[model samples]
Each structure stands twice: as C-alpha cells, then as structure tokens.
Target: MSRPRTLTDWQALAARLTPQLQGNAFINDDFVPAVSGETFECLNPATGERLAKVASCDGADAEIAVRHARAVFKRGGWSRMAPVERKGVLLRLADLMERHQDELALLDTLDMGKPITSALDDVAGAIGSMRHQAESIDKLYGEVAPTGEQVLGLVLREPLGVVASIVPWNFPLMMTAWKVAPALAAGNSVILKPSEKSPLSALRLAALAREAGLPSGVFQVLPGFGHTVGRALALSMDVECLAFTGSTTVGKQLMQYAGQSNLKRVFLECGGKSPNIVFADCADLDRVAESAAAAIFYNQGEVCIAGSRLLVENSIRDAFVAKVVAAAERMQPGDPLDPTSFMGAMVDSTQHERVMGYIRKGIDEGAVLRAGGEDVAGPGLFIRPVVFDGVTPEMVIGREEIFGPVLSVFGFETEEEALALANDSDFGLAAGLWSQDIGRIMRMTHRLESGQVFVNNWAGGDQSMPFGGVKQSGNGRDKSHHSLAEYTQLKSVWIALS
Candidate 1:
C-alpha cells in the first residue's frame, strides 16, 4: 500500500471510512440505540478532528446491556453451548477478522493514533489469538477424582455469566479481541466497554461478531466515558465478572467497585515500570543498544509492558547509554498514515500533555537528559523519545509509570544490585535482561518480579504463553490455556450408588 503524503490524503481516507458508531448496539438480536438517545463525538487523535458520533451510553444503557447478557446466559444461547460449538464460532470470528484486516487496521490507526503498519500487525495478532483460544477450547479438561464403592465423581468447567470487559485506548482493537475471543470461547456472554478515547474498532468488532454467528446479546459494545459507562459496568450486580486493561488507578477503582457491589471476579492488566537490564557480558552491544531503544520507543512507549527502566552494568554503562541515545534520536514522529513513519502522535492531547509533563519532571528531579526531551511542534500531539541517565530508584521518574517513550538509565555494580533494582518497583508487568551468561539468565529469570522476562530480546511471546503481571500491576492471565480458566468456573459432580 502506498503511504499517505499530506493531511488532505489522510482526511480523504478517513472520510471514505464508515465509522462504527453508525451501527447500533447488538442487544438480544437487535441493533438498538442508547436508552437516553445520547451520543458522543469520536475524534481522530492525530488531528484532533471529530470522525463520528458514537452512542454515549450511560448507566441505564449499561444496565440494559447487562440484563440482555444475563438473559442470554440464562437462556443457554451461549453459556450452554458445547465447547466444540463455541470454539467453531470463535474460529469463524477469527476468519472474519482476517477478511477485514485492512479495514480494521485503518480504523485503529485513525482512532488510536498508531502507525498503520503496527495497527495491521495488531489486527493479525488478534486473529492469531482467536485461533489460539479455539485450539485450546476442547482440550481443557477438569480433574477426575477416583472413588470407591460404586461412586463416581466428575469435575466440569462452566462459563461465567455476563462478563464486562473494559479495554485500554493504546491497543484498543487488539485488547478487545484479547478479552472477547477467549471469553466467548469459554461460553460466556460479554458486555464490552471500549475506551472512550478509541472505541471505533471495538464497535466494528461487535458487528463482526454478530455476522460471524455469535448469538445476539452474547456480545455487546458500549462506547462512552469511563466515569459514566465504565463505572456503571464495574458496579453492576448483573455483571458477574470484569476484565480490564488500563491504568493502575482505574483498575484499583474497578476492583473496589466489584468488591462493593457483588464481589465479582475482576481480571486486570494494569500499568508497568518494567526494568531492562544490560549486563557487561552481553553478546552484542549494538544489538542490545538497538533493542533498548526499541524497548522504550515502540508504539511511542505506550505499551503496558514497556521496558522504561534501563539497568546497565557499570563496566559498559556509558557506551550503552550513548548508543541507545543515538538510536532513539534516529526515530522521528510523523503522521500515522505515513507508512515510513517510525513513530506517531500520542493517543490524544491529554496523554500527550501527560507524557510531556513527565519529561519536565524528570529534568526537575535532577536526572541527566541524554536525548530527545522536547515535544515536537505539529498539529498532532507528538513528543520525541526521551532518555535520562543518572537515575536512582527513588526518583519520581524512576518509580512512577510514565506510559510514553521515556527511558531511565541507572548503573549497577553487581548482579545482585541489578536484580534488586529491577525488582524494586510497584509494577512488575515485564522485564528484559540482556546477557550471554547462562547462569546470569537463570538467576535473573528467577529473581525478576515480573510476569514475563525477556532474555536478550524484548516483548517476545506468543498466544500460547500466559501474559499478565504481579502485585499492583493487577492479576489474571490474558493468553493461552490459562486465560480460558479465567472465563470458566469449575463445578464438582458426585454420584452415589448402593
């Protein structure tokens, strides 16, 4: 595909696209509007221009959606479907997603301000997840207990009803698929609440789900503000379970709401302050430096598992920092529609301002600014990647979760100190360790307090592996056979015979 050259080209492409909010909410086999007939504007983050008007669903709309989901679950339209049958639907949905990959990717790029290439990759990843979940659906078996005296006991896994999924703005479409595909595969009805910042692709996914033979009300999409729609979903008693991918503060608030309302099952993938450690025995310094730059600069460093903290061994700290700074400087921010653009704007002005504020804070806190610390002047909210050296564990920039392309480098004297520094954070989503020493890899893998540890590489994982975090980073796994369990509940059956 050819790249868009100017703002007019981008706008022309967006104008030709039909926004998903034009479609109605798929509730109980019908496309319906919000109860209040309210709607909100969906903006293109790159240009701060309104793209479409989406339904601004509120508490009453959430209640209606949840009720329909509950009714469908109780009526056995989805929850009672055979595991194989559900798997077939999920696989079909995956196929449908593949069919619409280009459109979906474009929607994501326009709505979420991600580069089109990366958005296309996200669509492909979503398809892969659907197929992955389908493959594991029928193979998931419950334990069988041995009993004597002509008595038999069987344990079975059942679906959790009325799951409310709230996805993040960064990877909106991909995260929706992450929750929806697995939850549906496990035979649960879902009420998805896409982030207000970027809800177009998610709404589009809902339409596709219905087209792919998923029963109506089995999947519903609500687009609105988090304070209104998201809060309602979290506190709804009918929402038996909640799955969220967002900031730690919102995750915590949802947990409290779940606890206060019905103590619903809450699964969260929250923020991260992941450490990327570089040891002196690293195999390739150039590769490590490039990886370090990409680790914090990819997707504008909006990734929840982004390697923001760099812990380098003192022997090669100076050289590594210099190389990483040089690498980061080579990446330029431009329009998302430009295929050659390595980086794009932040999701919106708010996020853009937040990231810029963090950069200023880093400077004020006495961390040495290595490279690319200022916000770029453009119509879009673009901030250049920033790297800081002489960072300590206690500094605000070192401890806090800044979901942007900002890297903090700290020198470590020994492996013990490196491990300690890596683990010394409230968030433990993911960490990357660069070293050729087998013993060091083993030690760091065991010592690093993260859900995923990447050795040499960064953010390397498949749908077959579980993805999540420990401590304040939130609980519950996202991918693999483990995610299926999160959507299912086990029931024990006992039989007695004379």
Candidate 2:
C-alpha cells in the first residue's frame, strides 16, 4: 500500500492508537506508590493528552529500593545461581517481552510520541539484546593465566553487586535493554531509573522480569526526575555499579556522585554531534543524499549519534545540498501511529522550543535556509525537516547538539579539511564518511576519534559492534561482549601447587 498523503488519514490512525496508560514504581516484585504520595502527569507529545500520572519517587524511595537490591545481592539467590540457570531466567524475560510487544509499543508511542511502528521495531532490539546476553552466559569462560607449574592463576569475571541504570527518553526500551540486559544476565540485582519523560515501558519490563521468575528485587524500576531518584541512586553506596545513557552533563554528575559516595564503576553512553561526510569521489550521489537526510531526520533527530553536521566536498556541495533538501522535504513530521511517517513529534514542548530556538540562531548567524525552517503547525510538537546550507563551524547550530531535525551543511575542499572539521568537536560518539578511496577510508578510520565510524554509510552497524563515545560525549561501550564485561569486575585468584 502507498503511504497516506492526507493529514486526516494520519490523524485517524493515531486516534485509534490512543489508550489509557498508567504505572507506578516496580520494586521488590510489586507495584508501589511513592512514599511521599506525589505523582507527575505523563503527557502525550503528539496531542498534548494525559497518558498517565506516574508515581514521583524521591530519595526515600531510592533508599528503600537500594536496601532491597543490596539484601538480594548479599543473599546471592541470583548471583550464586549457575550460569545456565541464570540464562534460562533471562531468556524467559525476553520471551515475556516478545509476548507483550504491542502493549509495550503503545506505551512508548503514547508517552514519547515515537512512531508506533518504530517503537514496535525497537522492541525487537531490546529483546535481542536480552537474548544475546542470556545465550552467552555459559559459553563465557574465565582465563587461566600463564604461570609456573608451582602456581596456578585464575582470572574470573564476577557480577558487581546492585547495579543501577538510568536511561533517556529518546529510545527508552532499547537503551534500557542495553544497560539492564547485561546487568541482569551477569547475575546482578538491577534498579532502573528511566527518564521521567517516558517511564511506562521500563515499568512494564520490571513486571515481566518478575513474572519470568526473577527473585524479588532482582529487577526493579524507579520512574522519576534525575534530581531525586536518579541522584539518590548514583550517590547510594549499596549500588556498586552505575550504567547510564543520557546527556553528557548528567553523565558527569553521576560520575561525581559515584566519587562522593562509594566510588562505584560508572559507564556512560551520552550525547553526540556526529558528522556525515560526502566526498566528490562517491559513485552513488542519489543514495548518499537520501541517507544523509535520514541520518539527521530519523527520530526527529533525537538520536544521540544523529548526523547533525553534513560535511560535503566543495566540488559536490551545492548539488548535494540541493538533493538532500529535496529528499528531506518528503520526510515532514506526521502522526506517529502512521507506520509510513518516518518522523514524529518532539519528546515534549521543551525540546520543541529548543529546536526552534536553534533554527533562529542559525539564521541570525548567516546560515542560508535551503529547505525548511518551520514547524508543521498543528496539534502536536512537530517540526519540518530543517536544512541550512553555507554553515560554518563558528555558528551555534554547526557546533552545538540541536537534538532536532535541523541539518547544518558545511563544505570542505580536501580530505584534510573534512577530517579537521569532523574531529573539531567535543563529541566523539560516531561519524560517517562517504568515499570510494580505500587509502583515504583507511586513514580516516584511523584518525576519526569517534567510537564507531561508518564508511560510505550513515548509522550502519550490527549488534556485535560497540556503542559509546570519548571526550565530553562520555565513556564506556554498550551492546557487545564488551558491555557484559562492563557490568562485571575481574577477580584474580592464585593457588600454590603441592
């Protein structure tokens, strides 16, 4: 079937998707309200409707959760379980998530205005992350270090007690899976603090873990703002490790909290202002143009590794910008429930205003608006695909992370200039470059500071690849054999042979 061309059609489809949604904190295998009896309204960004009034937990609630998690960790009901047995429990939780895919999908779509189909698809990634870690349990082996016959050395990986994860709203379920999946699979009791903006999915996931026969306090969710529950978790001495995916600023705070308290291991996957380079030698201009548009426009450009900076070789700059602008026009925001809508609403009004403010600032700084510089102007917080040509490095839009569908295009004459432009940022999360030159590709790949680099593509990678950043973009990797290691600590034991 062809995509819906009318706004009414999209609206009708979205209307059918809206259902009453609500959830409380999930702790110790049950749903419970905040000790303070406070709650916050979860609003649908697409239509400004109330999805739910979720419990707003404070420091006291955080303490209770940590105490429970610490008790379970000490008891070792899960931590001491055999590898295959732990794997089975995690696999069952994944199965339960798959069974309730649609229900989980709807909660995220209504809560954060993510496209319903995309939300549904993201659930698969989350499930896959769980299953992958679960399946790896028994296969993982400890190392026998080379030593003299008189001495035997064993290096074993052991679970860190009471892991706490704080995930962002943009990709709620997927990010949660990246953190919690490994923590739980590694036999650590987990306390998750999902972003207040979108907490419903994580709340549901906690229940599923309980249903899958996880011990009490083995998996839990605390849905509230970062200042309260999140700060409390970061500062808790009982939480031996902290894994987070959010802003660089907040990631730094968590590190500080860890220092001030227990000095827990902190792993962060934070913000990015990743660059996408288009060189003159690329054979496929049309394909590259389309992908470049999608790189920044996908998820309304809320993605942490979004290619907000488009660096094109000067030879193809004018023509390429025109092609990219044309492609972006077709991707204007629509009802998130419409599967055909590649773009959706901003997570909320604050984000919407922030994007618009960046657009105005860019124009003021002399960036020529080549395609779009406006909102869709309707019920939702939706923006049109914004493209700015003739952007320079000094411009605020060119330098800062917009976290919107605002594309800033810059032109470079040589590979050296492109590399310089790409490397000149506080972020090093991911970068993409387009070229047919093998030597250049090899050199650029070596020089690029990002954790991941794509050759001739944008955001192309598999589950096995590590994801994270360097510099202010934050530390530690997620979603690979490496992530499982981050959730654990290495112990070395030596035995003297008789």
Candidate 3:
C-alpha cells in the first residue's frame, strides 16, 4: 500500500482498511459482548471522536473465556496439534497479517494515535515475531541427559495449559504478538486482554488467527478496562500463566493477584526511565543527536524503554545539546494519518494531561526548559518534544518515567559520575552509551544496571535479541527463544535401562 499523503487520502485509505464492527469481544472465534451487555466507547485520540463501542467485559466475560480456553485445551484441539501443523497455522497467520498490513496499521493508528509509519512497523514486527516463534518451536527438541550407567534422564518442555496475556496500549499489536505468538507456539490456549485504549488491533488479529485456520477457542481477545476484566483474569484459578507488558504499578498488582489465585506464573515487561549516556570521546555527535531525538520522541515517547534521561559528559555537553534540540525541532508532532509525520498525538486526553503535568513539574523543579515543553498549538492530544537542561537527579522529571516526549539532560564530569547518574534510577529496563573508546564501552556494558544496553545506537533490536528489564522495570524476557521459557514448564523424567 502506498503512503497516504493528504488528509483526504488518509481518510479514504482508513475507510478501505478498517472494518466496521459492532463492538464485541472475540471469544471462541465469534464476536460477542459481555453477558451484561455493557459497552465502552473507543475514542480516536487523534481526533477525539468515538471510533466505535467495544465490549466492556468484566469478571463474567473472563470466566466464560477461561472456561472456553480450558475446554479447548482439555479437548486436545490446539494443545495436541502436531508441531508442524501449529507452525503452519502461525505462518499462515503471519502471511495474512502481511497481506493486510495496511489495514492492520490503520487499525492501530486509529485506535492508539500511533503514527502510521510506526503502526506499520508494529505490523511488520508482529509478523516477524509470529514467524520467529513458529519457526523456533518446530526445530527445538527436548533433551536427554546421561544419568548413572543403567538410567537416563530426560527433560521435556510442556505448555502451561491456559495463559492470559494482558498487553498495554502502546505498541498494541507488537506487544500482543510478543506474548501470544510464543504462548500459542508452545501449545497453550491463550486469552488476550488488550488495553482498552487500543483494542482494535488485537481484536483484528484474533480474526486473522481464525481465518488462518486456528482451532476455535484456541486464541481469544477480550476488550475492556484493566481494573475489572484484567483483575478477573489475573485472579482466575484456572489461568496457568499470565504474561503482561505495562506499567510497573499494574505489573506489581498482577503479581500479587497471581500469588493469591492459583499461583499462576507471571512474566512482565514493565516501565523504564532509561538513561542515554554520551561520552566526550564520542566522535559521531551528529548521529548521536539524531538517535537521541528518536530515542525519546518516537511513538510520542510512550515507549517503556524510552531514553528519557540523558547523561552527557561535560566537555561536549553544549554541542550535543544544540544538535539534539535541532533534531527534535525537525521532528514535529502532526497528523498521525500522514505518513510524513514523525511524531503523533498521545494515546488520549488523559495521557496528554499527564505529560503536560510532568512538564510543569520539571519547570517547578527549576530545570531550564530548553525546547518544546508545551502542548502543540493545534487541536488533538499532541505534545511537542520537550527537552530539559541542567537537570538534577533529585527532580521528579529526572527520576520518574514520564512516558512522553520529554527528555532530561544531566551533565557529568567523569566516567564514574556518569555511571553513578545512570545507575541511580529506581528503574533499569534499558540504557544507551555512545563512545568511541572500546574500553569505556566495555566498562559501561558491565557496570550498567539495565537489562539491555545499546553501545552506539539507541532503542532498536530484532526478535533474535532478548528484551526485558531489572529492578522495578519488571522481569522475564520477550522476543527471543528465551520467551518460550515463560510460556512453558519443564518436566524431568528418569528412565531405567536393562
């Protein structure tokens, strides 16, 4: 699909791509609402218009979905399918996603205010993730270990029955694929609860799964608020495992719910206030500045691993700051439907207000508002890229995860001070270091508290690399073969020989 240039073209493209649905949850391969017949409006953040009414699913809906998932698992429908058969279905699903890439992108853009380019990237990522998991499960084998001479020990990986995947609004489609593809590949019945802020993509993905020949009830999407349906799913005794990607606050609550219920295994990829460190010895200041802008401004800075904090070496701080400001100025927030727009609106008015509040807090804390600290002049929930200079670690903006296009700059004199500033944060999901010195790169790689560190680049990796965080940023890895471990259980058996 070619890029839609004008607003008229964009509107026409959206109409062609998106399906007009009567708000309902995708359960057991059918669209239906909550037993109570409750519904909620899904608003277009870009225009603040009601896009559609989605099912306001609650505990009752969760129960029905769980029972359906359990029944399907017990019937040996998807769980007992041959590995090759499962792989074929997933590959077909990926193919379907590729064929309808434009539609998927439009659904995500309309639903969550993500820029069309980024939404398209999410679609590509979802396709790749599904294909990666599907390919991996087919080739992987259980291990046999030698015990004493007369016996053999074998370790087998088994699916954890029914899994509940609750994903965040940001990167809706990608996060869903990150959790669901691996769980489904491991032969588990999956019940997905996508964030109410962005439920369209998940619901559409469920439709594609069924069209790709997945067994009925094998995969389901429940659209509703997090407090009700999300809590119900978390507290369900039948849900064997729960995989989530969201805020640290909600992630902690889900963990407690898991312990209180069936003690279901929980895997989370939560919040981050990641630091991007740039040393004076780094020669590529231009590229560094470009990446720095992209690091914090992409997706309107709603990324969990966004480089919100910048720790720069004092010697080159001024030059780097100027370049970064220029880069940020070039990337303005605009209409999400336009393919040329680098930044888009916030997920909603609530998030927009929250981000503006953070900006005000930064000013109150006495940091210099260097650039783009206010909401854009026009309508919609659009906020310009904000950069704060002379920031102290004690300030709320420096320490907190704003989850917006806000960047805080801190200057340090030495490597020791830089490392200290980077590691002082309560969250450590991801960090970035830019330096030409191999020794500094090697040292920082070992010293940084983050789970993943980018040497020169910022915020990018493929499905092959594992992604997660440490400390308050949550636990467990996503994307790679390691993610399979989250959805599977290990069984060890000893066989006696003659």
Candidate 4:
C-alpha cells in the first residue's frame, strides 16, 4: 500500500498488519533453520505480545552463513562486478525498499517499540543511504602514485572479502543500512546479524536484496543471540571484517573474540555519555530548551549519542532546566502504533528496569529529582522522561551511559568548568553546546574530547560526515565515503619502464 495519510489511517493499517514472521536463518539465497531446529520468542515491547518465533542460530548456523559468504567472495560474483553494474543493483534494492516502506516501518515499530513516525524516518534514511552509496560507486577512481618516469605506481581499493554487520535493535533498519550499504558498495559479501530483540525488518531486507538481483551466497541475515551467533561471527576466520553498533561492554567482548580467532578488522560504534552544555549567552533560551529536551528524550532516550549529561552555566541553570523539564513534560510516552507519539516504550522489559535503576541511583547519590521520573503504569515497557537536577559530575548517572530518557543536569560557572565537566567522562561519542559566541563554539569544539560536536543543535547531521568516536566510545567511522573505503583494502602496484 501507499504511505498512509492520516493518523487514523496509519493506526488502522498497523492494526490489520500482522508480522509475517521469518523465523529461519538465510544463507546462499534461501532460508534454513539451525541444525537443532532451535527457535526463540520475539516480543512486541509496546504491547508485551509475542510477535514471532525467530531463529535461534548458533555457531553451526554461523558456520553455514560464513562458508557461503566465503564461497561467493572468492567467486567474485559481487566482489569483482563492474562498479556501474553493482550501482544499478543497489539502486534497484533502494527502489524496492521504497516500494515496501510501509511494511518495513511497521515491522520496526512493532518489534522495537519506537514510535511509528520515527520508524518511518528510519526507513526513509535507510533508503537514502542505499541510494547515496550506489551513486558513489562509479564516481570513485583509483589513484596513480607520483613516481619517476622510469616507474609506474598504481594504488587501487578492493573489497575486503567478507564483512559481518552486527547491529543493535535501537534503530534496526537505519543502522543495518549504515553498515550494509557501504560494505555492499565496496563489492563485499555481507552477513548481517540483527539483534535478537528486533530482527524482522532485517529478515525482510534479505528478501529484497535477492529480489534486486544479489547473487547467491552474497548476503544473509542471521537472527540469534550475541553469545551464540554474534560471537561465532567474531570468531569465524571466513568473516574478515566485523562492524558493530552496540554497548561498550559488548563491543569490548567482540574485540577480544576477534583477537582470539582470526584477528578480523573490527569497527565498533559503542556507548556514549555525551554532554549538552548551555551557556548564558545572547541567544534564545526557548530553542535551546526544546533542543535539550529532544536530545535526551528522543527514541525514548535510547540513542547512543544522546546528550544525557546537561551542563548549564550557573547564571541561567535554574530557568533553563525548568524550561527543558516543561518541554519534556509535553512529550509523553504513547502507543508505538500511534503516529502522534513522540515517546514510546523502552525496547524491552530489561531496558525499562535498567533505566529505572539508574534514575534511582541518581537520587541515592544526592541528585535532586527535577521532573517525571516515575514508571508509567501500563502493560508496555514504558518509563517517563526523567530529569535529575543538582547533579554533580561525580554522580553515577552523570558518568555512566544510562541509555535511556534520563537527563542529568549540572551547573557550571565558567568556560573552563564547562569544558572540564563535558570532557570528564570516559566515553566521548558526541557533545553539544548552546552558545551564540562564535569564539566559544570554536574553542569548545576543539577542546572537547568528543568526536562530533554540535554548537547549537543535537544528533541530526548529514550522512556525508564521518560518524564515530575515540576513547571508550569506540573507534572507526560509520557513514560517508570514508566508511565505504574502510570496507575495502588498498593495493599498490609498481612497474619499471624499460
């Protein structure tokens, strides 16, 4: 069906659409169960209903997928395809994604408990990424190294045989495309392991890839747990590159797995305790307040780059925090199927409890509860947007990556103090500062330890920018041509002229 027009229309469509569960591991262009025929339950977090029985793939399943990926990579069907030819196939996949937008968006909303509106946005972003990476294929050129007339030196980029993308359930479709598009653009066979919490859209994506003319064994979707399927991929010699977007703990574990096995190249986009600093500058407080609320509350505050730590200058801290709390109050949790819902349930019961624990820890450690820190009494895994005022930099909530809609507010006196508070965390994925002073913006961006800095905004950025971080936030860029190039290896050739 076409894009639903009204809220009623979307809600009605969601009601009628049942998840046509794909509960098998895909390999060599076909679906197959684990050797033991094991399966696990997939629940709808918003309603706490069983969505499907997903495949419980293990090391055996990973072996099957990896073997097929290796065979296809060596055969050079996708690996050696002409750049223009590969571009067309990816473009066709993008078109198919557009055609099936409604279904994909619906699956993500139902599976992960994100608002339908945000699910639609994620689906659209995924399609755009596919198209953008496709367009870049033919435009890329190999370089001729500068050398003497007697020598001809050439440098070319080639695919790194097989890439395994391990994506979290937070924004399933978008993150999967973030890794898969670039890996495929570089002409590598890809094995995608979507989070067991939400694997429906990824399963459906594999079907679209085959429909768009991906050759056999070039792509597969394995739905399983991190310990089994994820660890297996990290340990598989056939899987050359592992790209992951998850927590710092799991990211570290995967790195160890890589070291224990084949020493495969691992790129991790992990945890963040980003600081959102607001100053008493000559600017609009209302805009800053709204942006600050959305930064920590968007996606139920499950964002990796969420500005969880808010450092406000002492002069304007009270008024600014009040306005921010008011903005959050207006954005309440609602049914994920409802189009008007800006906030939805946590991804699962475990996450809901984890968030509540952090909120309690903040209060125990002397941070004042400012607003809306209670659990929503309902069937779904929902928590109210929480704000902890009078929070110090040493508080657990201020230092840890809670990964929920919980904000820790801190007061700072001067620029030096603000920088110190922002850079004190072990994680440094992103940081935001609200200031009109151009000099201050430039200085903060330079001095702050975060990888991405936003002067007056938070989280929304162009795909052309390389996205990743240093420190415990993990390394390696995810988006842009830089990511596409990372999936490939550089080969240098030299010839001596007679």
The sequence of per-residue lDDT tens digits that candidate 3 reaches over residues 417-491 is 999999998898999999999988999899999999998898769999999999999899999999999998999
Candidate 4 — which residues are off by over 4 angstroms? 6-8
The local distance difference test score of each candidate is 0.87, 0.89, 0.92, 0.91
* Candidate 1 residue 138 C-alpha distance from true site, Å: 1.6
Candidate 4 displacement at residue 358 in angstroms: 0.8
Q: How many backbone clashes are present in model 4?
A: 0
Show where candidate 3 strays beyond 4 Å: 1-7, 17-19
Residue 133 C-alpha lDDT in model 4: 91
In model 4, where is the ten-residue run with the lowest total lDDT? 12-21
Model 2: lDDT equals: 0.89
How many steric overlaps does candidate 2 have? 0
Model 4 / residue 25 / CA error / Å? 1.6
* Candidate 3 clashes between residue pairs 3 or more apart in a chain or in different chains: none
Candidate 3's TM-score reads 0.98
Off by over 4 Å in 2: 1-20
| Of 2 and 4, the candidate ranking higher by TM-score | 4
The CA lDDT at 480 in model 4 is: 80
| Candidate 4 structure quality by residue, lDDT tens digits, 1-498 | 567866687777766766456778888899888777999988889888888888899999888888989998898988999999999999999999999998899899889999999999999999989998998888899999999999999999999998999999999999999999999989999999999988999999999999999999888999999999899999998888999999999999999998998889998999999999999993899988999999999999999999899999999888999999999998899988788889989999899899999988988998999888798887899888899999887788989999899999999999999999999989999999888899999998999998899878888687788899889999999888888877999999998997
